[model samples]
Target: MMTVVHHRTVDVGGQAVFYREAGDATAPAVVLLHGAPASSFMFRGLIPLLADRYHVVAPDLLGFGYSAMPPVERFDYTFGALTDAVEGFLDTIGIRRCALYVQDYGAPVGWRLALRDATRITAVVSQNGNAYTEGFVDSFWKPLWDYAEDMTEEKAAPLRGALSLEGIRWQYTHGVPDTSLVSPDTWMHDHMLVSRPGSMDVQLKLFSEYPTNVALYPQVQEYFRTTQVPLLAVWGRNDEIFGPDGARAFRRDLPDAEVHLLDGGHFLLESELPAVTALMRDFLGRALPV
Candidate 1:
């Protein structure tokens, strides 16, 4: 494992955004946006492979990893807020354009960026990120929507508690064919992020807002179709949460997108990094005109 060589912070809309960067500074920029629960650590294995060829930037989203976590009263963890935070982060970094590798919760932030600043996106590589109703399994998420519908301080505590270490481990390894692959450090890191003061609240609030994305997926797909940018869907065939169907459906909106399905779970890149990294390199070569 390569040690973290650089760390920095930039204020984005009054919130301090923390990010770690590795690899060549002069190479083409590639931003790795991680999903919920996991931080930039999701790309631990893949970063080294691309760092030699690309300047890789990975940040712990608002409430994840080393980033700031204001209370729910102070920071709304809605999809809009998440998008705006990333937009501000990009502006602060002076990244006019970048190849975006988005995963899970990253879909909302990346989609928002693609729509809000279409010209700034060079290429899009998505892993298990969806932009259509068929991509979602409502049954898996119905309880969350129901909780949000009747949210209250008294009832929300249980939801917050559910993000604990044990809860996180369960969610992370849930439905995986081989649970032994999930490392202790992975669960430890994710649990640490959620268990932070008020961070759990932010996560739960974000969970509640998931329904909004379900309703807004059509808009995201339309934005992609309109932008006509290069898109790739690298899916984990074994993902229990978000199925392969989501990856297939992405092609409906992005007819030109390149799709690859691999044998892994929601966290495929962790288990299968080399193959994914090669796919990313190939995708970038095809998507970005030199």
Candidate 2:
């Protein structure tokens, strides 16, 4: 039987938070959090595959996808604020405990959720979701690093290019050995949302506060070491934004963490969906039993 994924929205602190949900309401939950420039849409393929065994939920974070985008002037665009919104979303949606499938920008948000309430997280599945300094690919991050060092319009101007169609397309195709495997729709959808009016500023505001995430790495690692929560890292070995080292670094804190490196890019699901899906199924089956 084909699992039906539902498109829905809920009021999270007065904001209309959009999400995709599937599987049984009574089943164990798996929340998928997306990266920058993308949304719950990225999990379109993985949701149904997991829905057979687990209740899968993927939310479009505020300022991304169909979620309400409060103006940067009114909203604090830091990871902390994003986490609070996600926490509130989970509460409003009645998800008390679940595994977290985090990628890119979702890593910080997921980690914050864990920090705020470790008891609510059953396991973690990180796909190119970096948390350690070792994960950084200096070349790709230098520009952002420069901007973070000096928060000025001049410094932030160059970063806007990443919001362009070409730049967004490159993120999807960059490390994939076979570009044909990637669907054009992925980048197109992302570019559409990211290029929306005022979206660039929202992203920039989040970018400017990225340093805070890096600073919280120590605390996150401590949580890992202490909690010893089940963790699986399926990384795109060729990801230029976050190298495989970041995936391996998890072992430093949680030696039992499972790490797998596949040939792909930052957007591993775009090129290696099958492999990623299989790994998640196996990991979650054991880590978060139904």
Candidate 3:
């Protein structure tokens, strides 16, 4: 049967969680978690590619994408809360087990799920997801560290630019050699979604608490050791935020993991979609076959 994506939302508890799904329900599931300043929208091109075989599900985290963006006072925007909502969403959607593909902010969200219940996961695809301290590079980490130290609007505003057009543009262009390969709409669309009411605050909340995720890295690594989970790390070598070191760090625990450093920036699918899809398909076939 031909594969097609369906943009849908499910009520998890009282909040609205929007997601994209495709493929037959009984097929093996693949959960794609996007990074900060991005929602399931990032998976648009890749969803149809994988949906032909596996059940692909990409959901917008709370306060992201088409999901309901409640005020900070209304919904605490922490990693814990985000995971709670995601796990609940999984239950509500009736997804019992699946492979996880996590990137940037999706790293922490996806790792939390793996740590919470290892049995629910079939395999892991780490795309620029950092699970080790060695992965923390200067260019991206320093500024955020400084911003987290001082919460003043002066510091916060520039940091907030990450949620703005210029920052989004920077993320897509900086590390890429062929600038033309990156699309302007990548940032433009994200800029529109993030500009929604109280959206920046939600991202800021996550920025402020990034250390918490870092603090739990040891545990995330431990879960890998105990579960011996199969892993496939496909990283965009040019990613300024998550340097190549972060991508290679997975081998520390899962030495048998398949790792690939692609020729692109933070958002690989933006420039190297076809290559990534090929690698992911091959990896899941060998490492996570149903």
Alpha-carbon lDDT, every model: 0.80, 0.93, 0.87
Candidate 1 residue spans exceeding 4 A from truth: 1-4, 152-162
**Candidate 2's TM-score:** 0.98
Compare the candidates by TM-score and give the number of the best one. Answer: 2
Query: What are the per-residue Cα lDDT tens digits for candidate 2 across 173-274?
Result: 999999999999999999999888889989998888999999999999999999999999999999999999999999999999999999999999988999
lDDT of 1 by residue, 82-173 (tens): 88888889888877789999998998888888878788889889898877766666655556766888877765666665577886676667
- lDDT of model 2 at position 81: 85
Give the poorly placed runs of model 3, Cα more than 4 Å off: none
- Show the colliding residue pairs in model 1: none
Per-model TM-score versus the true fold: 0.91, 0.98, 0.97
Better of 1 and 3 by lDDT: 3
lDDT of 3 by residue, 1-290 (tens): 65678999999879999999998788899999999888898999999999877999999998888888889998888988988989999999999999999998888998999988889999999888889888787867876787778877877876876767888998888777788987788899899988887788888887888889989998999998898899988988988888899888888889898899988888888888898899999988886676
Give the local distance difference test score of model 1. 0.80
Candidate 3 residue pairs in clash (backbone atoms < 3 Å): none
Question: What total of clashing residue pairs does each candidate reach?
Answer: 0, 0, 0
